[model samples]
Target: MNWQPAKKQNDYVQTRNKNFSPPTVNQVLQNAQKMIGPISESPRLDAQVLLAKIMKNSRTWLVAHPKSRLGAQEDVQYRRLVARRAHGEPLPYILGTWEFFGRRFQINPSVLIPRAETEHLVEEALGLLRNNRSVLKVLEVGTGSGCIAVSLLLEMRSLGVVATDISLQALRTAAQNIVNHAIGDRIDLVQTDLFSGIRGQFDLVCANLPYIPRKVLNNLQVGRWEPRLALDGGEDGFIYLRRFIAEVAKVLAPGGSVVLEIGEGQDEEVRSMIRLGFPRAPVRISKDLAGYNRVVVFET
Candidate 1:
């Protein structure tokens, strides 16, 4: 995506020194701080990640060799990435990859950048699978970037996954990730809304669907950079979520379970919807690292 800075700032220009000598790693980091410090929560770390990308090295390497010099092209690339971050573009999208569940996956504007909180949803799903040895099939709705599905297949060798998304662009991005991790044979990528074209029952159904309300999407700085199709959950922020729960009974196998990542302040309401769909199932909510209610699990 083309991410122009929301407001023009000297951060991009100020980082460029007009001298003949190459800029040292420390100097570049300082300049990046000057450009993005005000806008980023982790300015130094962002600077390091960008620089590391340019240098084809790790952040730890950059730290150890603070006096190393950047090539002319490297300096230019670093400044450009800093400008994008200052403008509110997510770092993962700028870098073209993000880490989730301890593994890295390709990412782009077409897909939502995987967040650490979503890892909790993966953890909950893994917990359920660990308890039930017979569970073999899994389905991930709104499988943007295929982070959840790919991670699950990697963790559980015997399981097969059928991941679905309404957007073809999203399906393409997820397809790249499935191929990248060499798990394409085990995961099927389908372009369909929720469970519309899905055929068989799944032992587990998981999703990190759009849950941000339309109105709320406007005010969010980070949200503006992400694809609306991946964030808009309708007026009440549960439109897509409600639909998923309603259709769970059709695809979920006997003794199967459903796990979903939800917005904050939405635990009880989502649990209620899951209960309405599966009246006799056990519905439970799980919290993220910050202790906020973030995942809802439905087990029959």
Candidate 2:
């Protein structure tokens, strides 16, 4: 399943015939569209992104310089990236970075690529902490790319977060983001199974834990490239959710809040689990812009 540029002389000959002259940005977009249109939802946009990456320029620049020609090396790299995307590797993975919560973070197959839906989780947490200016400590379970934790640290000056993940590789990705954002001193990255090695209480505990059922994951395009530890939520997609509810009480400060990103249609079930786990805590679910239940927040 290696995805590299076609290397055979015959392949090169065919490419040479197809591209007699160096490809202009517009021609490359058309080529990418033809190659990936069947699998990609927005083939033109995907082409623009890939070309932008190759040219080390912005998408806006691509749009303005459609007549500009790609160098030989640039054309080869663009084709290789397009081939990778056409084969189901995520665009963010191919680009090696993704924007989340208005900031860019380094990403790879080792961690789940941060999604726009997860931004709701960050917003909900920020809303809860807005008026509380006092020094706040937060615990983030399953800090994939550290997007949630780092975004929080950036938005809330009084906040400090301890982020944990079972995958050492994921922690490394998060670590790079921490340094990139200059939040290295504010975040502590630990490798442990959901709160196993964590200590102490915090003003808030948040997680975008794996909530996709094993069966459901098999059908997802994302399942092909993302780490299973970051996507598999066991048989019912609540295995980790239930476990977090069971153990979070120990490290959650009194009056501390917990926010989580849940899969679609699991809102009521997750809220019920929260009630059962912490009968005294108040629970509520928040929907994303499209109105799907996306985040669950509770206070102990």
Candidate 3:
């Protein structure tokens, strides 16, 4: 709630000279800071990082060489990037990469951006693996950027994974990420809604499904940028979630567990659904950093 908002860099540029180029990093940062002051509190920092990214230099260097000169071409490109940021484009999308679970993931507009809170799901999965030393089968539903699957493989060796998604585009992104992390051989990526074509029992299952209620999504800033299929849940926003519960019971092994990410206020309802669908399966919910119920756990 009190997080620092990154600043827009274009505000500093003189309006009369819309195309006026900043010839130095200091000039760029100063202009960015000026424009950013009214737009956001963290404009200076955001400007530095964006400029540094363009120059392939570290933030420290940007601060160290505030007076260092930038070439004509570099200034042109930096201004364009600054203009985009000024319009509220996400920095990660601009850079094309995001660090998740200690690894770098190529991120695009195709999937929901991986969040730090989801790391708890990964931690939960790791804890399960630790207890089940012989476990080798893992399944990840709605495997967005393949961050969850790739992170699991990086932690556990010789593990077999089945990552599924309903979006062909999302699957393609996940597939590329799986290969990028060199887990293609160990993990099989499939395009299916929930568990439509998934087979066999798995020792563990993980999902970060679309849980936002259709009504609420219309009111969120995330909806404006993220793909709707990756965010919209029909009506109460539990459509995919309900389907996941029914399908999970059929594919999960006895005594195995499934970890799911739930929307802010849907924890109790999701737990009820899981309980009704998997009467024998035990259910639990975990909170996110903000202490909101955010994950649903079911153990058979």
Candidate 4:
């Protein structure tokens, strides 16, 4: 009995466990890069940005903290975000915010991500409003994420906006952004189809409505995750464009400006619509940095 008990105790003697090596920032990023590199245009940068967002640190900090190990939960969350990005979900939707006109606005799949090209429209509107003090009120049809409205108000303090969206969820998103920028009182939100429930006339009407054609959308990723109600523009990509043009005259003020962000090669048709809607108004076409015919300004 003594020999058997002593042998069992020695066989079951405790052994120290080896130290666990958690995933370092560098290892995590490299793995993410391999997953995202195949799909994303800027895989490395995107990986860094997503990780930075998850870690609540800047991308620059990620560069410096390459050896730093992520906690178990952070690694899981970061990997999830990378998977979404790998699936071709827009970066802004994954990150929940995007820079438009030098300001970060709350964004999601409910609205179209504010395009850098759209900023050309904002800059054009700001430039037009700079000299004139008479343009006090604005109307943004299909306000989406309220990027255009919020940006306009932030840059020009004298303006008030009536942002209308057909989608209530979109209105909620826009409203959050309005509150985020503390411009609730300066802006009024209405859930109505183009100019349906809107009563007052706006001095400036900025509409970045759905201009992408339905036929071409199947091949593009713009509407894959974004709401089709916001991106599908019917047969010629001008269905809503036509409707907005037909009815916009009722809400536009005299000498009012309508600044539109048009898709590539739609400038001609947009000019035609503006000319048909407001015959007396002159249409000014401004190209983006890439030299695409982007922003169209029409004065009524």
TM-scores of the candidates are: 0.92, 0.94, 0.89, 0.91
Candidate 3's TM-score:
0.89
Ranking by TM-score: 2, 1, 4, 3
Per-residue CA lDDT of model 4 for 54-163, tens digit only, reads 89999999999899988756765776788788778878899999998888889888888888898888899888788687549889999999999999999998898898
Reference-based lDDT, residue 74, model 3: 68
Tens digit per residue, CA lDDT, model 3, 1-300: 111232444543343376754467787777766655564558888788788888989999888887788765566567777766666676677777888999999889998888998998898888878887784899999888899999999999968999998888888888888888887789888888788878899988888888888889999867987888989988889898888887787788878888988888888888788778778777778788899988777778
lDDT of 4 at 20: 40
User: Clashing pairs in model 3?
Assistant: 7-43, 11-35, 12-35
Ranking by lDDT: 2, 1, 4, 3
The count of residue-pair clashes in candidate 2 stands at 0
| Leading candidate by lDDT | 2
Model 2: worst 10 consecutive residues (lDDT sum): 1-10
Residue-by-residue lDDT tens digits, candidate 1, 1-300: 122332344534543657557779999898887778888889999999999999999999999999999886687677678888877788898999999999999999999999999999999999999887764999999999999999999999989999999999989999999888999889899899889979999999999999998899888875778899999989999999899888888998888889999998998888788778788988888789899999988888
Better by TM-score, candidate 4 or 3 = 4
Lowest-lDDT window of 10 residues in candidate 3? 1-10
Candidate 2: tens digits of C-alpha lDDT, residues 132-242: 989999999999999999999999888889999999999999999999999888889999999897889999999999999999999987887899999999999999999
Off by over 4 Å in 4: 1-18
